[model samples]
Target: MAKYIDLQTFTDARGNLTVVEKILPFDIKRVFYIYGVDETERGHHRHKKTVQAAIALNGSCRIMNHAGEGLPLEEFTLDKPSKCLIIDPEDFHWMDNFTKDCILMVFASEYYDKDDYIFEPYKQI
Candidate 1:
């Protein structure tokens, strides 16, 4: 299942600082970001073993996920830098409805491997 995590944030006169430490279930082996997106949606697949933690570093976006067959679809909004979404291997997911300035950063548990990707969305039940 996909779950939301609240990252620790410190606020002061300067500004706010959010940290991602000892929160993710897996060690980040790869990092990536998505920006400059248009009307089209992104992500419509699940991984074999990779786990990902997605954060909205700049603006906001919406994530839709399906755990598996017979499971209900889950929707989440990444609107804050302190909000993290954990995407498990079994969770078929896609991202959409992004703000123009949205910057989404993902921390992956494994390096890029084309063979690990399963380009299939779960059928809603």
Candidate 2:
């Protein structure tokens, strides 16, 4: 099942830290982030093999995801920097309702590949 993770955060007089390691599952490969996205619906697709952890580094955004196969669609409001939503390969996800200053950081298990995209119809990309 898809779920949210409260990543470990270290705090001190200096500031704070959110750590992610390979111990979670997949190794870090591709890292990206979205900011000032004008598209109301940023994604309407799923990865064929890549897994991801999306963190709301600043502001907030609402994400809707589906596991397909008669499963209920899930909604998540990512508003915390120390929190993340683990997205599995077959889950279709979309982004909407982003605050003006929202910065979404995403860590991927693999590099970007067009063939790995499964946009709809549950078909392969």
Residue 81 of model 1: what lDDT?
96
Angstrom error at residue 116, model 2:
0.4
Off by over 4 Å in 2: 121-125
Model 1 residue runs over 4 Å out of place are none
Q: Rate the local accuracy (lDDT) of all candidates.
A: 0.96, 0.86
lDDT of 2 by residue, 43-114 (tens): 888888999889999999998888877777889999989988998998899999899899999989999999
Native RMSD of candidate 1 (Å) = 0.6
Whose lDDT is greatest here? 1
Instruction: List model 1 lDDT by residue over 1-125, tens digit each.
Output: 99999999999999999999998999999999999999889999999999999999999999999999999999999999999999999999999999999999999999999999999777899
Q: What's each prediction's TM-score?
A: 0.98, 0.90
Query: Which has the greatest TM-score?
Result: 1
Estimate the lDDT of model 1.
0.96
